[model samples]
Target chain A: MIKIEHLSYHYSNGEQGINDISIEINSSTSLAIIGPNGSGKSTFIKCLMGILKPQRGSIILNNQNINKLSITQRSQHIGFVFQDPKEQLFKSTIEQEIRFALRKRKDQKDIESQVETILECCSLTSHRSKHPYDVSITQQKFILIGCALGMNQDIIIMDEPTSGMDYKGIKQLAKIVEFLKKEKKTIIMVSHDLDFISEHFENVMIINHHQCIYQGTFKDACRDETVLSQGEYKLPDIARLSLMAKHQLCTTHQEWIELWKKR
Target chain B: MAQLELSNFSFRYQGSQDYVLKDINLTLKSGQFTLINGLDGAGKTTLGYALKGIIPHVFEGTLLGEQRLNHKVFQEYTHQELTKIIGYCFQNPWTQLSMIKSTLEEELSFSCENVGYALEETRFRVKAIVRLLDLSHLIHKNPIHLSLGQLQTIALGTILVLDPDVLILDEPTSQLDPLTRRRLFNHLSDLKKQGKTIILIEHNIDDFLELVDHLVLLEKGSILDQGSVIDVYTRSLSIGRDIQYPSLTALLSTITSLDKPILNDNDALTILKGVKSHD
Candidate 1:
């Protein structure tokens, strides 16, 4: 479990990145952080990742303060996928990248088999031997996710994982996410892709104007009209339809289809 | 004139043995908004580069067949001259920044100044673009300090200042907030009305479906299909391929009785309600 208390970060330019924000993330559940562009979502994630030290507040992981942990130690507990794939990917080949992430594991046996499982999960088996840059941008994203999974970190963080991915790539990612959830891993993501969020995440934290405007279930947040203004968000397609339908607030295609079948 | 055409087009990057793009053909007319989409690794970016004149000029490659802009061939126009006619926004907005310039205003005007536009004309165009993109607040700040969304707007601004007749934007709204995405589309719509052609490559063609005159689906470095949005999307879906539609469009398509794809929420509600009544 991870807990944050009154976390705040101010840029050197005197602009506040995030202001006095606090939220608790339970293990085995997904939490999505969303807000307008440049609205402190990334800033909060950075503080959590130890890339940026908070001027105020603290982050405790399993009762130990994350601030005290070294960057390498912090990385062991938390696996991070950067918004830009280029930032996180450096290995020569996709398969090699996953193998590299699995380096810290104590188990000597079944290493190759474990890499195979991760490759299949990421739908990157076909491209295993290919260079990271040779593949599409979306494939690079999966490679990063694959590395994170291979690391076997308790907590996984993805920043804008769905940006350039297409329908097929997204389905593949959703499948892997389901696999991860089954393993009871704590998943956190920051994204502008609302449909993906609506389908996968239950809890959402809305940061706007350098503060947490709302922290609750996505369904509740969608019903709250204030979320739309405070977070500078336009209602996503499914949310808009769900609002207009006024039956049950639906956020996914399956939910919408089921609601239609009822009506 | 102002038409882009390719015939039997293929390209292989200099070092690579395999052709990454193959057997592609397209004719984009003036003022048409064409959307190129497919799954990742489908050579969409390579296709964009081919159309943008970046392929043969910037990247060394084995180019086959022909690419024509207006009545002239690509070789006929110098790289500088091409900028006057075509503005291409890259998939990665960060790379689009002219890092030499510190301030956003200077970055936006770099293209205009480089192209030898008169001082008064450059100022006029830059001002107009800033206003169109709602970028006044960030004009003085260093662009490197801006977020991806802000940088995307500024990157597009850098292209818009050239007053190019055709704009090729790849995933331009990937980082933008929904409202900003809507606003950016609105500006593009305005530009479309003014007779500038647009070629957009994106995974989710949700917000700007109305603006898309043509939809081309790429699969594994080839054209899977190309035509009106509904025809191509529905045809692809029939073959058990997910071409990726907006949530509303996807929802509407689930009902087999719907005559055509609809985007508006109220219309979707009406069609869904009617389907229920018939049941």
Candidate 2:
């Protein structure tokens, strides 16, 4: 479990990026963080990653204060996939990229096999030898995520993983995230892709104006018009359609159809 | 005359065996808002680059085709001349940034300055674009410090400052939140009204369905389908192409045997209400 207490961060320009934010995230669950641009979602993630030390408060993971931990130690517990895959992908080939992190862990004796497993999990076994730049943007993103998974972190935080992806790519990523969840890996996603969020994440935290405005289940977050509006988000299409149909908010098209059939 | 035209267009990067774009033919009238939908690696970005005169010039590719803008051969124009007529916003916002610019205003003004616009004129364009894009609050902030969505807005604003007749945006709203995406589309609508021919490459077609005059679907570097928005969208849906349709369209199609295209939320609601009333 991760507990954040009264966290605050100020930007270099003296702007308050996040203020008095507190939240507790239980292990082995998926959480979606939704907000408008520059609403401190990234800042909060940075604090959690130890990239940016919070000006005030503490972040405790598994009863240990993460603020006091070294960067390498912190990374052992948390893996972050940045919004832009280009920032994290530096290796020549996809296989090398995934192996780069695993080789660093002293306990990862079978790094080659670990890389092979991750490549299979990410559906990139065929493209393992291809240069990272040669693959599509979606594949590049998956490669980075694969690298994070290879690190064997307890929690993985993905920032806008679905942005710029086509429908097929989004579907593939949805499956990968589901696979990760089945493996009991805790996942935190910061995204504006409401469709993906509603379909995958059970819990949600809505950030607005440098603070956590709402935190609840995904269904409640969709139905909460005030929070949605404040966070500058629209309910996923199926959810909105279900709401208009005077039915309970549905996350997926199938669920919406199921509700329609029942009606 | 078509505002922009391409015929028998095909291109392959130097030494590349496979063509990135193949046998593409398209025409756009003045002020038409066209949305190009394609799967990943389907050559949407390459098409945008070609339309912006970056294909044979900057990228150095084997090209086979003819392109014309406003009845003039596009290749005959130099890069500077093309910039005056076409503005291309790349898919990656960071790639379009002028790294030297300190603030959003300066970033927007950098292009105009590069083209040797008068200082006063550059300032005027910057202010107008800022107002149009609702970026007043970020005017003085360093663009590097801004979020991805904010930087995207700045990148687009930089291009808009040039006032080119043709705007080619490759996934401009990919990084934006829903509200900001809507606002960006509204601005695009305004630009469309002002007679700018806009070509957009997008996956999220929900907000753009109504705004788009035409839809072009690309599959594996080839034009799979192109027509009026309704025609292309409905056909794409019927054929089970991996394209995403607006949710309302999908819902209406599923719930009712309605053959007509429902473009927006209100239209879908009305159709749903009509169905309920009959029941």
Candidate 3:
């Protein structure tokens, strides 16, 4: 379980990044953080990843205070895929990038095997030897996800993973999320891709103007016109389509179809 | 109105034996809104380079065809003339920004300045683009401090400042939220009414379906499909191609069978309700 309390962070120039906000995330639930661009979603994510220190707050993870944890110790608990893949991708080759993440792993045994597994899962096996920059931007995103998978952390956080990705790439990522869930890994996604989020995640966190305005299931978030307006989000396509016929919120296409049929 | 035509065009990058674009025969008429989509590495960007005159000029390669604007070859046009006529916004917004500019306004003005516009003319175009794109909120903010979505808007605004006849944007909405996207969509619709040719390459076709006049699908350096938006979209769906299927259309097709394309939310509501009444 992860607990956050009174979280606040201000930039060096004294501009508020995020105001006092608090939330608790259970390990069993995956989370999607939804908000408009520059709405402090990145600020909140950075604070969680320890990239940006919170000026005032407490983040408790499984009874451990993350503020006191070392970077290496934190890596054991959290893996991050940046919003821009370029920030996280630096190695010469795609293969080397994934291996670099596994360098600190104590299990020297399955390193090569693990690398192979991630490459295949990411559909990057054919391009393993190519330079990360040489591959298409969509492939670079997969490389980032592969690196995070290589870390094998308890919590995997992906930021805007679907940005600039084709439909095929998005489907591949959906599969990856399923695989992670089956492994019991807690996933946190910060993205504007509401359609993707609605399909995969049940819970949502809405941030706006550097504040946590709402935290609950996606259905509740959708029902609230104020929350949607505050966060600058549209109704996910499926929900909008379903709501056109009925008042109920439907998460998936099949579910919407079932609801309509029953009605 | 300028008509851009590509006739038997094929290009192969230097040192590569394979052609990235193969015998592409197409015409983009004046005021036509074309939407193109495909999987990653589908040569959509390469096609953009070809259409924008960057292929024969900037990229070294083997070429076996002709690209003409208004009956003149692209090579005939001066670089400055091409810049005035065709404005290409790249996939990566950061690369398009002139980092030398401090604020968003200056960054937009830089495009006109680079095209050799006078100070007064540059200012006029910059102001017009800002108002048209609704960039008043971030006009004075430093571009370096701006977020990715903000930078994307600034980058696009810079191109619009030039007021090119043909605007080619590579996934402009990738980073934008719904409100900003609608703003862009509205602006583009207005631009279309002004008779500017708009060719948009995107991974998400949901927002701009109504704006698409023609649709093309590229795959592995070949034009897999091209036609009216509904025909191409329905064909693409039938074949299970990798093109981005509009979510509402996909759902409606799976659950309910509406012969006509479900272009938007209203289309689904009206079409499904009409079908049920008939039954």
Candidate 4:
């Protein structure tokens, strides 16, 4: 659904331009891009969204060079959720924001029904009247997702959606992602929450030193010691516990409980 | 003596009808690690500001009780005096940083210059704090251009250079990644061991459960519960309210069926592993 080739772009400050990056994202699948603070992950996503035009490279969406299309035209094919919630939300209420996005391309007769369906799928009906900025960061994220879904864009890119959320909040987001999966909306998320990505996302991409170093299944990529060390990432808690058991630090928790019972 | 104390305190922001904090009573001794846990909009930040004398002073609110820092009544102390005794890092670190600086070193000097510290002493303090936080590499980076994690470290470095008796942070790890969050907590843990009184307003219980000596829960601007870490979790769980313990604690709570629930991450891990062993 999304493709980038030999992409090279630099900031106005003259920092390195993505360093000839090339990658492809399949349709109806999720890809998580992970990296350290300044590894150009955000730059890569922006180029894909056509927010920044790569100086020397081609970005193709559905077999057409995105460089040839206008920003709004590219947005019809790609939807982006920024890292900062405040940047994405300017509407008075949650319903109004989703409605505004729907009104752009949706027919006037079908707008209300489409808005309702997306809001329901995103679990934002209860907060329809509430201002987008007034809601919690977690809820603001869902509101963004609802607006993106309203556009019914082919590919949705989310940046750091789980940075400040608690367990309950993270679970709430995961449930929405699950629904998107069923709806076959291709997803690309930039997350530092390794555990969240490993559990939910099928495909993982590790961007290190301004290059795509690893891309594969979440389980395989996370367990790779090289990627973990280079990206400063850690395995999920369950995987870490399983690794500890291999070292004979301790057996399963159930085994220890049984021994205590006998004692 | 407690570094901070609040007794029967209540506060409601001006122009608001209801109190954001109600009937709060607690004491935090110097050199102890304390965690303040609460749900969204539960007045955790309100209580943090109240402890730092920001409630009635910076934020116009009705105050209905006594608060003291280092045995000095909060109302009796000047804002400068409060700054010396208590260092409060607001939830948003960006707002707290006020200097037009390009580097972390310059940011530290901005604080020192404002306080009129001698040049030699300011340099020494800045170097010491930078080394303490392992921020030697970032000493020259632009504060605005830094990442969220780096900005948090710089914010903390600026505060620690002042050497306040009590350090209160509101959601310090809310914007950091897992790796950065771990590093930040390690720095806090080291500060606690060095006899710095630390108060953290946070929701990431899994990271700090084992380090916190006391746990306080707030709801709708009222003190819902406060006690030792284990006591608060146990009491809340017995009443059927979900305590904000780590995942391991929740799992063990189900297996043991005990009224006295544990909230510490290390304790919960031990218990969960034991259960797994038995089964």
Q: What share of the true interface contacts does each candidate keep?
A: 0.67, 0.68, 0.62, 0.23
Q: Distance from true position, residue A75, model 4, in Å?
A: 1.7
DockQ, every prediction = 0.57, 0.56, 0.56, 0.31
**DockQ pick, better of 1 and 4:** 1
Pairs clashing in candidate 2?
none
lDDT of 1 by residue, A31-90 (tens): 999888878888889889989889999999999988867668799889999988998888
On the 0 to 100 scale, the lDDT of residue B50 in model 3 is 89
lDDT of 2: 0.85
Better of 3 and 4 by TM-score: 3
Question: What is the DockQ score of candidate 2, to 2 decimals?
Answer: 0.56
Q: What is the TM-score of chain B alone in each candidate?
A: 0.92, 0.92, 0.92, 0.89
Model 3, span A202-250: residue lDDT tens = 7899888889989998888888877777877888878886677766789
Q: Per-model C-alpha lDDT, please?
A: 0.84, 0.85, 0.86, 0.76
RMSD of each: 2.3, 2.6, 2.4, 4.4
Q: How much does each candidate deviate at the interface, measured as C-alpha RMSD after superposition? A: 2.8, 3.5, 3.6, 5.4
What does candidate 1's lDDT look like per residue over B155-267, in tens digits? 88899888789899988888888778888889899889998889999876877888999999888889989999888766766666656766676766765344456667777
Model 3 chain B weakest 10-residue run by lDDT: B270-279
